[model samples]
Target: MIEFIITALEALALIAMAALVFNSHRNRFLNRYFALFLVFLALWVLCGFPQALVQEPSDYFITLVFRLAHCMAVLATGIFFLFGLGFYLGRAPGRTWRGSVLLATAIMAFCSLSDLIVRSVSYDQGRFYITNGTAFPLFPAFMILCGGGGLLCIALKRRESIGPDRARATYILLGFGIFLGLAILLVIVLPGIMGSDITSDYTFFLVIIPTGFTAYAILKHHLLDVRLAIRRSFAYLLTLIIFGAPIFLSYMIFRFAFESHPNLETAISIIALALAVALSPSALRWSNRIAARLFFSGLYDEVGLLHEVSSIFTSTANIREGLAAATAIICDALGLKQLQVAIPEEATRGKGNWVIGCVRREKDILGFQEVEVSASPLFLLHDPMLLDDDANAGVVEDVRNAAMLLEMRSRGIIACLPVRGPGGNVGILMVGRKVKRRALDPMDVDLLHRFCERAGLFIENYLLSSYLLSMFEELSETRKRLEESDRFKTDIINVTSHELRTPLTILNGYAFMLQDHYERFAEDERRQYLTYITASCERLNAILDQFLTVSRFQAGAIRAALKPTDLLELLAEVKAGFIPEQGRRIESDAIPLGVRVLTDRSYLLLMLKNLIENAIRFSPSEMPIIIKAEEKEREVMLSIHDFGEGIAQEELQDIFQPFTRLEEIDKHQVGTGLGLYIVRLIADLLSVTVDVESEPQEGTVFRLTLPHA
Candidate 1:
């Protein structure tokens, strides 16, 4: 009974390991061979059950099962060699190894099944045993060669491998050595030397040791690419083991102690069901916890981290501030030494190419620094990378990327995560080494990738928002300018009609009078009438010239050619352009010559003419207008001073605006309010500064400052 139970458990363990390994990575050739090896071992263990139980009448069946089990053992040895070779080389065996294995398998299989290898099987003392034929020694010799060769390959690989690879190789070596060495000792050495089968019953049970080790390596050290899937699968497997163990024990107790009493057996079965049901919830919880710890040494809530990052980006009003907060949070959560967030220069709206980052446990921020996008190739990289990995050979081969990576490594950065946008990469996330300088595990890499994906979404949204806002502001300013333009057009129409009507009316009336009454009037009367008509025509011409100058400015047809210009000569021209009555009051004697400045000659002359005309219109007829020029180290300052009816201080800037008039239109009929407006436009074109100081009663001064040539 003990033997039967042990054999059943052995078959269960072997079959379970086989299914788990095969399902974990069915696409991998090494996993397939490993699983096939376990299945054959399960078959050998299962053959034990029937061999021990079959009656004398079934001797032929027992012999067939016995021969098939030994044949399967030889096949399993061959498969193990293939698996070991693949695992050691990190790939499937080449054609040469495959052909050799096939040839060896065919020979060994023929030898195991031949009548000479297993002569016969018989039942003795309620147990089945085999009587070997003369050539059976060949079968043991083949098993020793194949199994020893597999162990030797793994032992050599363990020496060459490093880190996780070395650890996995060591486990494989220890597992296969223990299982195969003990099997040989129990199955062949003792039977041949001591003429006893004392340890034969435990031979198949030793398969569990190797399978357990492989499973550990897969779960703990990431032996295969199926780590993610195996984590959950291992959890479910543990849950089953937890829920099944007590029920199996209960059934064993009932079968041995109370099988004859049907009522007690039924009660024990019910109690076992109740116990399994009661343990299920706790069993599942513990299983998940164990799997979490086994796969990830320190498990983190990835979903929670995602939610926290999302909240930081969405809830914060400022995008840069949110990035800083997210960087700090991520650094603390991942136990990183530092985390850097690099945004594009254009995204900052011409401020700078900024890299915002933070250091672990340090309240003082690592802060932003100017790093040109061309100098740092992080912006150009589209894929996330670990700087230390050989996979980054492409990055290291390129000169720019290599220099950037070298600088990053010097700063202790381990990973370069690109925050991608629809168009391209919008930003980069540089992850520093862990707190203790530990290598980043698979889980850490996965979390950072996912975080970068979310960060990409956040950054893209901010850029979109900023773009929309700038567009909105531009639209608003355009609308305001259009409204102001509408008001300006209305003012131009009103001023043109009023100012032109007076001059045209006076000129027409005086000309008609002179033509009709030329003979009747005396010479002085006719001369005075002719002078009045000429003055009106000159006033109309001046007004038309001012309007034409403003029209050229608005049409963008006015161009200024700047060169060395004499300040005193330009002032003399301004004084000469004024009417005889206004020019007489202009005091130009105080002005000095030889002051030269960099200015457009035509535009500067127009500006000075407008200022002198403005002073003549506003000041009293009796007061003298003063024009002065001063030369400094780098510039020349020219001022036009008016002492009559000085402008109010509050209206100084208003005087520069187009169509703005402070005095009553009826009283200041000679002024069009466009003189200073023209002065402002011409000053701007020549890059000159115009300044005004005024008091309501004292006086007003218009100063022009220009840079020297």
Candidate 2:
């Protein structure tokens, strides 16, 4: 009867697990695999139920059923192994590995079809014996091969690629090891010692070992969201044990009594039934009490309550709410009449310091009191509130004063704790005695101290949260101002482009007309017109290019085609194209001709052109603009030196910013204020560094450091 009950419960659990797997099928792979395993386990249990009920030897029908069940279990095990391997690979069984799974499944199926796997079976005295033939060795070999395949697949995964999923693989390997070890022991070692007759019952335990491991793996790893299923199974098993055990025992007792006394059988059975019925409520209550006491002890409940209090403290933004919640928790936990928390007046007055304020409480019993001070304001002034000989003096005086006041009223202090936040001495917490003449115990003091420490953390967190919120508000306002400024800059660039283009076009047209018609005029007139037109057109084109580059960079449309090119060649091209004034000498030292670098050649050329143009525009007509290059460790350094009115120290930092030009320099040198900005942007994209050194009334040197090829 007991075996039947166990089988029934196992079956129900299996069905429930199946339903869960089907419901969560789309969500988890492990559940589907484990659910199939449970189905086979349930069938295996059912096959043994009839034999257990009859207390008889096994028959051909039962043997056939058991063999089928074993086949199912093996197939389920193999599938689970493959699924575990797939999980490690971060994919489902793909073409690369699916053949292995199919081959293993086919081998197991063929083995099941051949009777040679378990040649013969016999039973005696509730023991079933199975004789394994040569084919039996192949079964173990097949299992080992499947397990090896899983291990190999996992080993192939790159070490860096293996993430948290490695833990699931470990679980799978462990479960397989346990299952395989127990199977071998039962089939080979146990039968030799205990004889084959004892194999049937022991073999069931071997199967259970692997099943239990699989269940644990599923629960711990959430391998298919099977944790909920496991939890529900536990709950169901507990419910059955609690409600079913007493009734089952009572029924057995009544049956024994009736069989022993035939004359009084009916009466005794009725009395037993009546007693069981009468005790049902008490039995349930007792069971509930026992279970609750085991699972939900008072200490556990208290811990849970403390956790809830902690959550409230952490989640709340209001300081007053946190303080109130803390006070309530302490008062309730300690069973105190009143709890008072005080912050030091002096601590709050300082910029970022906090001191323990004074804590006050009323004495009870006709409003009379005998007050005992736990901590004082002076004690908190030391920050940590250390209770030493030197620090205790002020505390002792405050206690004396409180005692005097209490002598007039009549209430005693229970305990006092100093509260500290990150900034130190945030407050002091005090609890009054529940009854007159009662003093605080060691446990009370410990609890209060812990509560105070937690309260301190909460207060500190609150202050930090407030500070963060203020910072966020300031950042939001700053971001808004920046957005508006950027939009205004864009508008100014658009208006300037239109305004500058019209005048430049007319100037170029008239200059070109004079240069063309000057054949009938003087040679000097033609030369002057050509120079003016060329210089004006070049300046205008430079301004337009800077603006276009800046807009493209800001819009994230700039693309760099990087290749190995000589820096000297690129710089030379820029110099030859952008001719400086006649009297302004441009000089280049003998740079390494073939020093190749990997960068966008066009952007590099543009950057060098900007530097040379800026130098020539700012320097005096007769001064020389020098370009030099030298190789450093892992980098090539290039410098463009200008003998110009140098930038001021205060303005050096702002020189690279857009629309920022030297206030003391020539105002007539038409520039869009974007040349330096574009230069900096291109350098940044190439992972290069740009630095400028200058002194007032001297000269400025712009340096570029590029990674050496």
Candidate 3:
């Protein structure tokens, strides 16, 4: 019974070790060494469980399985030593190493096939022994040579520049060192102390300590952020352990309690089995909670960090302050030494090129680095040369290079992360060494990536806010200048109207007096004086009206009063009102008499007057001004066509703006240039459409459409 218990325990341990080895094969450093460790473990278990090996014919098959498993383990150990040496030196083992591995594998294969390496093997009285063969001593020497070579390579690698990853490498080497030392001591000194015969089982226990330590380092130490797999493995093992322990204990207790009676023993076994079955659900739930807490600590921490970052982003308008808050929060949470926030430099050039906006824990004040984008020849992956001895160097260089390269290529990298929010790469967030100067583990990288991704969104939003703030400031300054200019324009209009209107009013009084009281004057002279006074008064009135309209529009007080009016009559009256002058001709066309329109009569009149007046002022003395009123379906169309030096197509759109006049026009026109602008405002309020078709030096046409009554 004791022997069976020992065999069962050893079997469980061997199975556990095999599972660990299988998992380790999927990893980098653990891949090669784990297989060998499993072999040694299996050998130890088998040596203890010799009865199981001889209990049945199937036991022979089991022994053959173990023998094959042992060979594989030995071969893996030899290869792993060479591979580990190469990894430590930061380069692959050269041709010499490959040749040695291949030669060793071939020789081991031949020995296994010929049985020459183990001359004779016999099993008697449930005890097995192996007779030493020709290559027995040589095999031990090979093992020593491989183990010693690994140590030597590790020593050489230590002499080179060691960064944050050095400590992790040290832990691995120490584990190997302990195993190697134990192996050598067992091979050389154990036989002398414990008689002539030596067995593999005695040395197996020493391997468990190093293997346990290695498993811990790989799973918990963030060795390249591979924590999830480790955590899952631990959870699986824990579940099994929790379930198996009670069963094992119950088996032992029941065996003792019913040792004297076969029937009692069967009854106790059944009861224990029933109890284990009933308690499994509770065990599973407990194990699940423990696993979740262990694996998702970073996730919980990130949720809190995201909230803090979001608050900072929304409340702050200052770009630098926002960046500082974001970077500091992330760095503190993730245990990073440095952080950088960058924006595109070519953003000012109308193309988005990235520029470093801010940096934390950097020696250079000019944190901005220009990135060159390329395609075809991709940048190296995490260049080893970039790593600096200082904790910040590797992270800084890695992040900078990654950010620049990603931005250039327009690809995303989640190199390290829980990625703060979404999965897309926002920007690179590099993490420096931990407090203990150790390299970032896989979990750390995942968490950092998540944080940076979330923080990147915040950074983008802050930058947008910053841009909007700048635009608002510019608009405010422009408004101030416009207000000042309006005041100055009002002053000029007030002074000029006062200065010109007084003379025109006095001249009109004189002309009326001359015509009424001085009848003896010549007819031609009287007529000339009357004409001069009339022209001056009209010109002055027009100027004053233009200024008033512009001032009203600028003050946002322009409104139109809509009323029904006769369109044909209004046009005829306006045509008759224009006095014929030398070298000026006015042409007018009237529509049907009943053609009526619901519009702001005053506004329509003003619009027509401005269009006619503009055509006359710009046209040559011989050019005819054509004004046509026509009735179209549901609307009245009024067109003022001018045969004059017309406007360019480009300037047509700006013609209606106040104070805007054609650059090519003669500068002697007496008008404030607000006629077209007031016309547009009046049209808009009455829901009228105004369109102009103009071609340089050909002629221009102004068309207006008002709703018909």
Candidate 4:
């Protein structure tokens, strides 16, 4: 009778579990297969439950019941294999595998019903048993093959799966392995080895263990996602354990202790009931806590999540670092595989548009890929978007959005939430599929929405602050440049005025001398005065010419007219421009004739003149300046070598900058500091390469390389 009661309860529990699973996901193949397996398992238990109550079962009705029970067991084992395949694939088993299962089921069912498997049913020694036929070994062999194959599939899934899927696989594997292995042991292995039928009666009773695990996995690990059922079941179970344990314990103790004292037993039972009632409030609190912790460990309360997110973003100054940290926390709290943040490339100043902030993979870090979808379009979504149920199709109405979603899905992203600021949408917070592969529930979406909102505000404020700080820095730099310009202007006025005063005064003095003593002076004396005036005027004209060249350079009015020219002629023309004293110091003898380059004659001439003049100004009076030209494979190299107090290394790089003067060199040299600056400008326009090498007290050399014509 007790066996009958337990069997009935186990069958009913399996039926209830099947109903829950089937109702949880009516369309999913995984759910359907698992539920079908449970239903068939319940049938097996129900049909076999009567075997325990059968005493003299040698009739046709009793034999039919026994055959039906074995047939149900065979069918249930096949379905269990199918369920394992579906669970492993996360979908229905393929047509080939299903066809094979159907074929196997037909053969197994026929053999079970006929006398080939179970020859007869009999009652002996207060227990019921089946007499095996010649083919009875096939039944146990089929059971081993199907059950072991199912366990192998589940084991493979557990090894490969991550997060909640791994947990589910583990639970199912444990449950299935324990019950199936025990059933095989009791029915076949032990019955043959120990030579006893002692454990056969309890073999079918073990089905409920795996059934319980499957139900738990469905509710707790989101295997089928009957979350509400999970909560209620936990609550009821906790209530039973917390409130009923004490009362049941008291009754058990009092029943034995006060067998003769009925009055004392009644009083103690009443007191125990009162104690249970007194503890109900605390028990209820604990029940809620345990349920929440067990099933919803990956989530926090909305307010707490919001507050924590706010703290993270507000406390961080760097946008990328902040997003990374926040996403890491959020992914952990929400059980996500990866969380990505996409902002406009413009806003990040060309850093990157997508920040793959955090990834929660198992054991291996996922490789980061550049986001192919333009983030500009994603910002258009004002609300959060969940991808299509198929996940291969798009959920949005627009074509572009659909395409973007397709691209997103290709990259493993399943959801996109807009991060909007006061102005508008600023960024997108993208999440990949959950680690557990569960659908995004309302609580998850709500938390993500709130997180995006906070992120938008934080990013907006941070960008605004960055913009203001950049503006302040720009203003500060502008002020510094203005100060530098003012100093340059003052220096230019003082240097030019002093340079012009001497030349002008000399011209004036010579003119007055020539005018006043023209009749009394000799021809040689008047001619000398005229020559002095001419030299001073030329000096003035050269100064004004330099000023004009600098003005034209600043106005971007310098244009080079190119032509082929002889290097030797160019050298002569540049040398002739210097006064006799400077000209006499320069040597241009080391040039090969017929060496030519394509260049602007005027530009090349001016560049050479400036370099020669700079050489004359820096070198000692007695030292000779050598001008040389060399023909190379691809180019012609012209060099002006000066033996002078050479430029310092630190000052060499800055020598081409306008108004830059060497501080360590002789201060007596007279000219605007535009010689090298003009050479550089003309060099650029003429496509000529200019290089300088110098050493203190050794000499300086400026080499100009032009392409050979």
TM-score of each: 0.62, 0.35, 0.43, 0.53
Predicted structure 3: clash tally: 24
Instruction: Mark the regions of model 1 whose C-alpha exceeds 4 Å error after superposition.
Output: 1-301, 345-354, 359-365, 369-375, 381-386, 391-412, 422-424, 515-517, 587-594, 624-633, 636-639, 644-653, 662-664
In model 2, which regions exceed 4 Å deviation?
1-531, 580-584, 662-666
Candidate 1 vs candidate 3: the TM-score winner is 1
lDDT of 1 at 699: 79
RMSD of each: 10.3, 26.1, 19.4, 17.5
Predictions in order: lDDT: 0.77, 0.62, 0.60, 0.77
TM-score of 4: 0.53
Query: Candidate 1, residues 283-360: lDDT per residue as tens digits?
Result: 887888899889765555556788898899889767667777887777877788888877767655654566776776
lDDT comparison, 3 vs 4, better candidate: 4
Candidate 4: lDDT over CA atoms?
0.77
Name the lDDT of candidate 2: 0.62
Off by over 4 Å in 4: 1-316, 328-338, 345-376, 379-395, 559-573, 579-601, 627-639, 649-654, 657-669, 680-693, 703-709
Q: Write the per-residue lDDT of candidate 3 for residues 298-383, one digit (tens) a residue.
A: 42244557778778777876655665667666655554545554333322223343323233345332233435353211222222
Give the C-alpha miss distance for residue 212 in model 2, angstroms.
Answer: 38
Off by over 4 Å in 3: 1-73, 82-103, 109-113, 121-131, 153-164, 188-195, 199-201, 223-227, 233-290, 294-382, 385-429, 432-439, 442-616, 619-709
Please give the TM-score that candidate 3 achieves against the real structure.
Answer: 0.43
